[model samples]
Target: MAKTSSSHYALKFHRTSTWTMFLVYVILLVSLPDSSQEDCHCQNGCTDFPGSPCPGTTCQPDWFGSYCQKRNIARGKSTSQSSELQGYGGPFPSDKAVDGSTDQTLQHGSCTHTGDTTSTGAWWRVDINTTLEIRRMRIYLRRQNTDRNMGLQVNVSDQLCYTLSADNRQQTVLNIDCGEALNGSSVKISVNGPYLTLCEVQIFQCSNGWFGDDCDKQCQCQNTTEVCDKETGNCRGGCAAGKHGPGCQQECNDGWFGSYCNKQCQCLTASEACNKETGHCSSGCAAGKQGPGCRQDCGQHHYGVNCSSTCGQCSGTSDCEKDDGTCTQGCQQGYSPPLCKMCAVHFYGPPCQGCGHCKDDSPCSVLNGTCLTGCKPGYEPPLCITACIPGRYGENCLHTCGHCQINGSCNAQTGRCERNCQPGYMGPLCIQECADYTYGINCSSVCSCLNQSEVCDKITGDCRTGHQSTTTAAAGASAAHQGQGYDDIRLIVVSCLLAISCVYAVITTATIYRIRRSMKILKAEQMQQYSTLQVRGESSVYDVIAERSVYANESIQRHGDQDPNKN
Candidate 1:
């Protein structure tokens, strides 16, 4: 009886301990948080709940997260689906998925549902309007009928983000993390079957140039205006000023600056580069250029470094070129071209005039137009500007001209006569007297004087008094007769002498006649021979002289035949 009682007491105590452990396990299981409920808490402070009143704040537009700090980029965006279900929860549309509601009930009309069809590829989509780096996506589904969500896919711009498996389909809420973030303008949820459903969908991204899960990390972007990728921290719009590399962390190479390091420095020294931010050269501008950028050209009429050089004498009133200070319209008269700083050759004076004829065609003085080497022929003197006067010619007008037909007329340079010389003169200068029994203008007329040895008067061709001695003797004889008395013995003596002189003159005349006649006869015969030779074209100079002599003899015979005593 004592052994049985002890066994019964031990059995009762073990049964009591087992029941207490079962009760503890049941309590712990009941108190744990449900996986289907949202794990979010009011960040700013929510004032109300769907079924209960509370002192908490509602999230602002596009705001989400525990602290309401992150932005839901897909809220209230445009939405569409493959097909709408019209009856069961009537008018279930795609926009219901992004209406900022997380309600999963079909009767409340907040969830999206596609019509039942035989086609596979049932889908729902939302356009966020602009492209963004999506960090993650959160989706809410109906609590019951979760098996219909299996094989569902989340896509950003048609790129697969996540796919639901049979094991995780039972979960009412889904959190999809987009590794490295996805760049897209629209988001889509697709299923293999024709039926699809969603209560709410949220898309998230970091702020400009910020990335990471908490969006606390800053991006190293080259361009300040460009946004970096949310996951990779890379600038998609290229590097900023003076920077390069994929992440925009590298400094620009030498002599390069500005966006993507594409701009080159314009410093005065070619080896030096300009400031990276402002593109300013530390040194002065290059020649013919000015301004802070060293890109603008010098002002008109100014050139060289800093535009310090002035222009030269250019034509008109226009200014010179800005580069080399040259005259583009040509230089002033008598001035050299291009720079125009000096007088041209053969030119002179500030007013500038052409030079006179110089000796050996040499250049004249630039200041006074003076022929430094002396004047050329026909030109007079110190300035060599005047020509030699009439009748005066030769070098420096020193030599006189010849006695030309027109008095004082000759070439100024050579002193050559214009026409023939004066009467009683010969030769080019007309200074030589007539010679060779010739006395006339140009010494062309022959002199006919009785004395063979004496030439005629150079001016008049008059013979000497001795040439007419017979006339003078006759006059003397008449004078003596008048002075003497008429005596018989003198008259008788004069008569006898006169008679004798007459008879002797007649005899002498007859003798001369006979000789002349004989000479005429001989000359006539020679003339006949000359005529015959002329007819035969064989006449000579002697034949012509013989013919003339014959005619002269005939004339002398006719004269001789006349009586000398007769008048």
Candidate 2:
């Protein structure tokens, strides 16, 4: 039985030893450093700080400190608020306790108030100059105020962050954590108690785009960089050239221009680009422009790049536009657009004006305003659009026509007098007048029967008076009595002459008888005897005398017949 008992005891001891070894192994495995925590590595021994509450191996993202437990960000970025209360100590300023210091306490250096006021609605505030994200906040309560029971409230950015009841002499500190950080710029603390006091108030920075304890500043460093000077809140190594301002959060204004907008621009005129740094004109200042800043239009005679080249002489005082130096108003009289150098053909007047009366659809000389062809109709030439001047007509209005009765113009092309001539004037040119015996058009018609001194119609040849001239009447009578032939007129004239001669001879014989009677009886007898003697000797005296008289009478009759006007 003793041997069996010994065996049992030995078996039990072995089993117990095995159990103890297993327990030791489990403890060893749990106490050793975890190899899987490699990614939690920290530089500069960030996790070796004394009095730190952080774990030694792992760090949360965006958290870096002596113990890998603190976040580098901003806090209290906006205004803070507090309920009115008298501090227990002599004038303990609220700002003194929240000044990032823990040395002050309610009895001596902290913000404290002594009164029987209710704990509810009592508050204090701190102002963060700017908006920010707040990660956490720590409060150091007065050391001597353990007996006071109070409900504490903490708010961040006007939103409730924490609520707690004070423990009986168990804790004098309060720490509020905003799990994901609160978006705010201010911190507020409120408590309902017999006395309100604080030693120090501390706040941690957030993970968002902010830094500094007051959260009044922004992080402008490159997004690739993860570290900054936590105290000064400066971006490490400064910002890139394109950025400026405290955190390098601002970009340069867009004043740089040319090529890449990297080169500084120099311009003279307001809001214009220039070539020189001082804003003067230079080569390549701007395409197709002149003057400083490339702002002005090219001169009337200049064009192309920088207006360096001379343009064709434009007729008018117009110039090219600045953008491309194109003559939009059209080049000068003789020049064309763009360069304004090419010769341009144009009609007279503005663009809408017609070619006037110029013939053959011909163009005019744009430079001189001259017509290329003759005029049309009433219009004269060279420019040809105008009507002929008074008394002028033909191709160039060069031919002058006769003046009309009312001084009217003549035919434009034919040059005929347009209206009838004044009274006495007649014919196409009005050059002829009424003749003494002839009148009217072409002077072809004879004047009507009237006195020679009387006036007659120039056009109709009508006599003014009803009576005829004596000479004309006589001629008519003579014509009626005689035949149309000249020979008949001669015979009538001869008869009248012979009758007059016979009467004249009889008168002469009577005058001779009277003279002989008076001379006497004495001569009468002698005369008779002589006469009888002569007659007997030669054929009688009376017969000789009578023969001679007959011959004289015949000659006189012949002469009278020859004279056509004698009658």
Candidate 3:
């Protein structure tokens, strides 16, 4: 019974506690601010607020501040005021305007208030620290005394951006479009009234290549490198290649091409257009022109289509015709007219120059102008155009000339002396020395030396003997006569001596003949006496007489006598 009673009391207590908690939750829900209303006031979504249970809100894109009313660009930037408000609720500075706050209450210290109430031009400024292309501005005016913001002028870098009239005096927020040209690093707000007060200043800049309200438009720039006008979207630099017009969306017209369509085509037909991108002609080039663009003229010595034809041999330093190969200035000296391709009668080579002097006045080789039959007298061989040099002559200029008078040259054909020969020299060439016993020019002078073997000087006719002959012509003749006389005398003497020798020989022969005859006679007589004695028988007497006769014969023979009486 006690446990059941305790359980029933605990159940009633639990019921009473649950009803009280439910009443407390309902009261809290009714007392709190509407979350949906708060969310509606916020631009983006809400976040937790500092020191409050309620959530805070964030700004939309390009917006800032607690209420999302200030531009993100001008928030927290450097600020200044022409003068600061002094005394009670005074000291309102310019920095309060760009503090990313939209609070309009002057006592909240979120607005700028100039102290000079008597002066008309009270101003506040902010330096964004960077040049920006601002298209619009949102000015938050002080709710109380809104007349102070009337006749206010907004300037960007000293250029007038907008002006607020008296009709805008009661407005808490003024939306002003400054247009695309209003770009600057600093923004200023000035009132023509006595004082100036601004709760906030918002600056809105469009994104790159976008402009106009909400920055929903894109730019139409011709050059990709250049930026277009923020509002008008016009290319400020120029149109791109093959494009024309302000927006750079049109194609090039006929006969025009390249950048801005400024270049004209150079095609073979005057009405034809060229390539828009490269300025090349589709058709062939005009006459005397070459290359893709047809702007280049033909090269030197070349003409006609594609410069295929070669020029002819023009006269002097002139060039040939560009349309044809004709020599407009005339052909060279010995070449034919018009094309100048053929050479004249006795001419040769490319220039058709005249030939050299050949033998017997004959023509030379047509190709090289060489003397085919050999060169004429006094000239060199081969070309045979030049005469022989000094001291040289003959067919090929091979033979050297002889020594001539006064060192003069000899005849080129015969090698003969031009003048008389030198002294001691004779002959046509003046190369022979004077003959024996002769000297001087032409060997006309005679030698006067005593000895015939002696020679004389050929140049001076001087004798070479030990002693010189001083005898004149007449003296020489006389000496010659005397020599002849002495030779005659010698010849006579020799003749006489020969005659005496012959006589002596004749006398000797006679004496010898007589002695022999006497001896023969004596012998004959001796034999006769012996015979007579022998016949008389007187031998002894005959012997004595014979002996006496022999002695007598010997003595007669020795005496050269033939007397038989002595015996």
Candidate 4:
């Protein structure tokens, strides 16, 4: 009545066979690395990332982490069961990427990689194993630890999706349009650093900027232009030129403000009295106040106005009476006269005996605002109207222009001018014309001119031929042609590498799958045989091998046609 070892083994095999096979199936579904990961280059035109894969071309070595840059998912439950089957390592947040799998028709088992897989900086990325037309994408994060966090960032490309960040542990949700990658065959997602575990990822058919069932557009202020939350209409903190503040609100800088930061304020200095509101200073202050706001009076013998004109020393008293600026008793009745006015020559003055015949040769003829002596050479004219022309400069055409005429600046000591024409301006004073084929900021580059090549000015950085040349007007084609040349070379190299990678990926995956399948079948039969033998029944190793042969053949056939990742 007691079971033998062989029988016990057989019993275990039969009881656990279903679960075992299912476990193996699950492993195959999730654990196996996707073949698409190997040839992740995009099939669609590169629109988002700077150097993502292009249609009909393998990606160049350079990469951008996200498949479609920063995308938001518009819909789908974050906890759908089918999502678990999406091929990737995470049911939990992963270090390298976030990805999923489905039974959509596959070409090369394509997937996406997000964020950087290389840098020490935070990064995240993802890869899609099958082609699915996505509606939208969502990337969400909750209460972040800013100090510990570098920041939250994501990039998605067609080939490899990578994600990384110093403080990405709070990130939780990311949704993307399934259709976006459907035609291309892959979706890549990346993060700057680490992102918190995902809740779910759903694919739907939605408009480019639309999100949710309502198809509401995303932050709409501008394309990639950081705007304030769409609902609030606030712009992002960093703004473009001439714009400032959250969503570019509250412009204020360069001494300007109000609506557009265009208002200017006057310059103020400690020595001048300034208008409080406008910051301008028009005149001196009143008595009792001195600095900046001047309300103080004059000193000692001086009183009103500016403390400049002085009152005479009267014979009656030592000080002037109350601000009358003169002795209340009147210069001791010294005959007659105002406080400080000097006496005329014929009539005795109160302060100086007289004006002393007022000499015309004294040079102070202008009085308060005059020069004490005759003017110098260049300074002879009343207003000094003329500036030295061309070759002449200084007090009276006194100095030579420094250096040669080719350069333009005078000598520091003599006021002489000099010149250096650089390349394009090859003539005298750096004014001669440049070569027929060169132009740029420094004249260091040649015009990549062909048919009607762009003729840039050799001396002044002006386009010598653009106004007359037809080639200058066809910039678009020229640019495209250039890109084509570079792209063609890049494509050739990439294609070769991709082909090799794809082939290697396929072979490796098939080998692993076959080996794993074979092992499972053999193990199961061994268990079965052991159980039978223990029960006093018999079955050989050959029986176990035979049972798996058919399954093996079928697996091999399937791999030949279907994608190896799905296997």
Candidate 5:
């Protein structure tokens, strides 16, 4: 109720303003003084406003009726609501009026008005800001009649968008030919009173076109030009060259594609896929396509009717699908079909995604026991169907599943068929490789051989004996072929040691004999050295011999000294 009261108050205020403005307008109209018939004052009005003056160079000339009466009647209107009941606005100075010298029929009377109602301020102060696109225009008259001579004029633009005058007010239709698409805030309009009032206006896209010679009431406004030919009504834009629709706008008959499309999607067969651009159904599918999306595989399902859904209930002739003759996984024991895709009464998993009661372990063999590729990990059921019950793995709740022996899923990668037989497997797919000290085909059976013994080939579980060349081999023969048989290695080693010993004795004897001869020579050289360096008593032998000769000389000297004394 409060909101409603506020709206009522605002509306009342608006009506009061309108009524006040209307009263002022009427008072001004009544105050307007009549001019003499001789006055031709349009000569000055033309210079101020855009339009040319009347032929006599003044308004109210005898040639025309009284201008004020005509102008007032041309723009007047009846507003029945209890608001300001005033006539339309009057002419303004500095306005642009249409060129009316040439055609008198195109002119408006002397008193012209120009204004727009705006919410920002005084409505009469706002400028007409719509820039029209289409070229032709018509003026609409309310009640003011005499101000009809003035036409429209635009000050800023060189190209013409529309024409307007009081005469056009009488004409029903108008054409606005826009030379270009414009983007701006406003377009100013100056009609002859050059008088003007605004209804609503529109702007069109570039490349506007018209058709149909008699289209006075109708103009087709559709983008119809991309079509091929006019006869086909298929030029991409516009009504096919020469034709037109009701309001200069209607779609073509056929052979076209667009918002004005007259075409259809096409392909080879009626069911075949079609191109969006062209309307014709042409080439068929590529190699594999049968149903729709080139989707099929006779090599996979091995069935009929475009290999539709997996070949169920197959006939006998095509037993199982084979690529280059490799026997594929076939059907179950109870059921035998062409593709091996289905199962009989109590069989499933590997055969059909079916259900059954697996009574015994041996009966599992009747269906091959494992799921289609076996359940994922901890998951395991009757046929490895359900999970292995959290703690258990393998076919039944038989083994545990954890980091598994192999790097993959232990229960899944290897079947827990072996009962604590070896380290690698406990159930079935003994996937783990041989660990240290262990070697066997399935790592099932242990070998009693030494570490890295080359004692046996684990894969075959047969002793791995190496070979040797008899001619140069230290062992004298290959372990496999020799009488040693891994036992004769010691014998060959002893023989080789004995042979080395005999050769060593012969070499030792020759070395001893040579050493003896060299020793004898060394003994003689040592004796000479001893004689040269050894002393007898205090002197060496050489020294002692020289002393003896010296002693003899001394004795002779004694004799000579005695003789000299005698002399």
Candidate 6:
């Protein structure tokens, strides 16, 4: 029975040991990362805080992570389905190597340093999830193993691309070019060392339509090739036609113009349309157009593109000057040179002032209005601009007529008496005087009897000397010589009338003193005649007495003339 109990205990112990081994294996399987999950390095602290050391040197600011990989899948939870990495023990599992965490970097209690046991020919491989044009690969060493050199060899899609045999010295990172952009989806790294340690493994593929390291640069191939240098971003086959410059952004040369330099030039013919930028006509403006821009028409009185100027009022056969409008030949009859416009009738000069009245009806000089002849009437000249003063007349007002009846005014033009001349003077100009023996009304009357002198009154023509008794008869005969019977009769009748008037005046003056004496004598005589002449009447007697008295006076005057006055 002790033997049976020992066997039962051993069987129980064996079952428990099997279950423990299964459980332990299950735990390890749960902890180990699946190779089909986890794609691209996140670059962790380096990506989050630029310029911070990534712990491993493989990733730089120009790249993404310790392995300098590219992110090819959609980020977050979706990234795990896109890729995987095959490796060994780390803070996490081998597939977690590319999660972008370093040996020191931890997240949620998980660390991402991927390492393997020290064994012969340890290797790590990455499935990039999609086909990619792979150019370069970098490996980041475990930060803790500073002195060790793991001579690594890299292959892309089963093609051996690079070997690290020449750089066997200890290094934090390693970079290798895969020759051309090797068409591949998987990258494998193997090292001939005791073990392989990788904090992270990364696979790179350029983003869609990109070809450079970080896929941050764009390709500018103008011809639609859309291909350029992966590093320099230079066009692979040069820019397309009609394009120039390194970026293929410039157009054609100077002589060529237009959108694509497709249009030919017209400036060669006439030098028009010359400017490349503005396409303006530089020279040779059209017929009527002028100005620098060839946009203006000729100005007023100007013609042609040179703006040749012209003006009005030109005369003579010779044409006017286009530049200044000056007359070339002589001026026209009434017009002047430079401008031949006519002047007003009375005005003359270059600018035609008043001509005034000219002497002798003479015309003035056309140029200066100077009176050629003397001034007319009251006017005087150089220019005939002034008039004569009061009582002055004739050309230049130099002469005077002294025979005016009252004030002595004369004609301004002729210097003749405006009215009749003075008593002795006659003629239109009042220059003639009465003759010595003749006078009165144009000197037509003759001198007859005189009282004082041989001369007669100049205005009346009556003799001034006294005449004798013999002269009276002579005067009558002389009167006959004066003209016709009218003169003879006129002289005799005037003498008799004057003698009768003198006698009447003497009788009337004497009557005042002898009125009473004459009345008494008349009364006595009338009484005697009144009775004797009663039959004849008183009126007849008085008439007879008046005749006798006139005869007596005449007889007495005759006696006194012969006696040389009784004094």
Find the candidate with the highest lDDT and give its number. 1
**lDDT for each residue of candidate 1 in 1-567, tens digit (9 for 90 to 100):** 889999999999999999999999999999887543232234444433222312343455665533343567778889999998889847998989989889988889999999868668899999988887675888999888888888999988978889888889899889889665677899999988888889999887665555556544446565666777666667877766767665565666766676677766656787777766445777766677777556667887787777898777789887777667778898888888787766789888766777887888788898888899888888887567789888787777888876666875677776766677667777766667788666778777655555545677776666673342455434543543454445656888999999998998899879978986787687787777666554433556655667677688678778768985696
Better of 1 and 5 by lDDT: 1
List the RMSD of every prediction in angstroms: 28.1, 31.1, 38.0, 68.5, 31.0, 34.0
Q: Which model, 3 or 4, shows the larger TM-score?
A: 3
Q: Give the backbone clash total of model 6.
A: 10
lDDT, each prediction: 0.74, 0.57, 0.72, 0.41, 0.39, 0.56
Question: Can you write out model 3's per-residue Cα lDDT over 425-498, one digit (the tens) per residue?
Answer: 78886778889767777777766766655787878877656434466544764666689799999999999999
Which parts of model 4 have CA positions greater than 4 angstroms off? 1-68, 71-233, 236-241, 244-364, 367-567
- The candidate scoring highest on TM-score is 1
lDDT of 6 by residue, 244-305 (tens): 45444465454434333443333323545444333334554444445533445556544343
lDDT for model 3, please. Answer: 0.72
Against the true structure, what is each candidate's TM-score? 0.36, 0.31, 0.32, 0.17, 0.20, 0.29
Candidate 4 residue lDDT tens string, 1-567: 356888998988997997899999998899876643433333464443233424444333222123322222322212211111233432232311223322121222321222333444433333344444443455433223333223433333343222334444444444333322334333333223433223223333323322233222233333344533422334443333334444443335544322233333332333442443233335543322233323334566665444554656555556553245664555543223456343322223333332112223232222232223432332222222334444444443454443233445443324533445344544333334556655532345455434346665554445534443456545744775698799999999999999999999999879889987876787687667555553322456555555666676687678567864665
Q: By TM-score, how accurate is candidate 3? A: 0.32
Q: Which stretches of candidate 6 lie over 4 Å from their true place?
A: 1-92, 102-119, 146-149, 165-168, 213-216, 223-567
Residue-level lDDT tens digits of model 5 in 312-336: 4344334344222222454445454
Better of 1 and 6 by lDDT: 1
TM-score of 1: 0.36
Report clash pairs, candidate 6. Answer: 313-340, 450-465, 450-466, 451-465, 451-466, 452-464, 452-465, 452-466, 453-464, 453-465
Off by over 4 Å in 2: 1-160, 163-199, 203-356, 377-386, 402-409, 421-439, 442-567
User: How far off is model 6, as Cα RMSD?
Assistant: 34.0
